[model samples]
Target: MSDNRTWRARLIATSAPAAVIWIRVYVGVVFLTEGILKFTRPDTLGAGRFDKAGIPAPGFFAPVDGVFEIVCGALILAGLVTRLAVVPMIVDMVGALLITKLPIVWGDAPLFARESGFGDFLHEARLDFAQLCGSVFLLLVGAGSWSVDARLTATARSAASH
Candidate 1:
C-alpha cells in the first residue's frame, strides 16, 4: 500500500552528515553494553534494580527492557532504520529518567541508588542524559552518508528514477 511505502521512505531517507556516525557509535555501544549488563549484573541493573526502583512487574519488564536495548542498539550501530530504532530508545531513556532519576531530584533516591542533592542526581544521571540527547539527535537527523539506511535510500532513489 501507499501508506507502507510512505513509511518505508521516511524511515530510510537521510541527509545527515557523515560525522553522525560518531554519535551513533557512542550511543550504540553504551546501550549494547548496558543491555548485556542487565543480565550479567542483575543485582545492580536487572530485575533486582528494577524492584528496588519500585517498577511494577520487575521480573517481566527487566528482561524485556534489556532485549529492546540489545536489539535497538545493534540496529542503530548498523545504521539500519536509525530513526525508528532511536524512537524506542528515547522512550526508554525518558522512562528511566522518570522512574529512576526523578526520585533523586525529589531528594529520595530509589532503594538501589543513593542521592542527597541535585549534584548527586547530576552525577548519577549524566549517562542517561547523554544517551537521551544522542537518541533524540539521531531521530531528528537520520542516519548519515556512511550508514546502511543511506545506502538503501540511494538505491531506492536510483531505482525510482529509472
Candidate 2:
C-alpha cells in the first residue's frame, strides 16, 4: 500500500505540468482570435468600438492594441517567452475590464443599453475576468515542462554543468 501510494504521488506530480499546456493553448487561441477579429472586423472591435467606448485616440490605439494581442498571443502559443508574453495580455485584460466592464457594474449605462444591473454586468464581464486570471496564472507558472522555455533552461543547465 505504501509503495502504491508513493507511485501514485509521483505520477500526479509528474502529470501536473501537462495541465499548463491546455491553459496556455486555450488562452493563446482566445487572444489570437480577438486580435484577428479586430483586424478583420474593424468596425466592430477596432476603431469603431473604441470610438463608441470613448477611448481617446481610438484610431491610433485600436490597431496598436490589436498588434500587441497578436504578437503576445503568438509568443504564448509557441510557448516561447510565455511569461513575458502574458504581461501585455494581463495589462490588456485589466484595461478592458476597467474601461469597459466596471462602468456597467457601477450603475453607469452600458454602451448598448440604457442601464444594466450588477448581475448583468457580472455576466458580461465574466470572460474578461477569466482571461485576466488565466493570464496571471501563466505569468506566474510560466510555460511549464513541455515548453520552449523548459528546453532552453535545460540546455543552459547542461552547458553550465559541462
| Top candidate, metric TM-score | 1
Query: Candidate 1's C-alpha lDDT?
Result: 0.89
TM-score of each: 0.93, 0.86
Alpha carbon lDDT of residue 135, candidate 2?
Answer: 85
lDDT, candidate 2, 79-112, per-residue tens: 7788788989999999988888778866774464
Per-residue error (Å), model 2, residue 87: 0.7
* Prediction 1 TM-score vs. true: 0.93
Model 2 TM-score is 0.86
Clashing pairs in 1: none
Residue-level lDDT of model 1, residues 53-81, one tens digit each, is 88999989999999989999999999999
Pairs that collide, model 2 = none
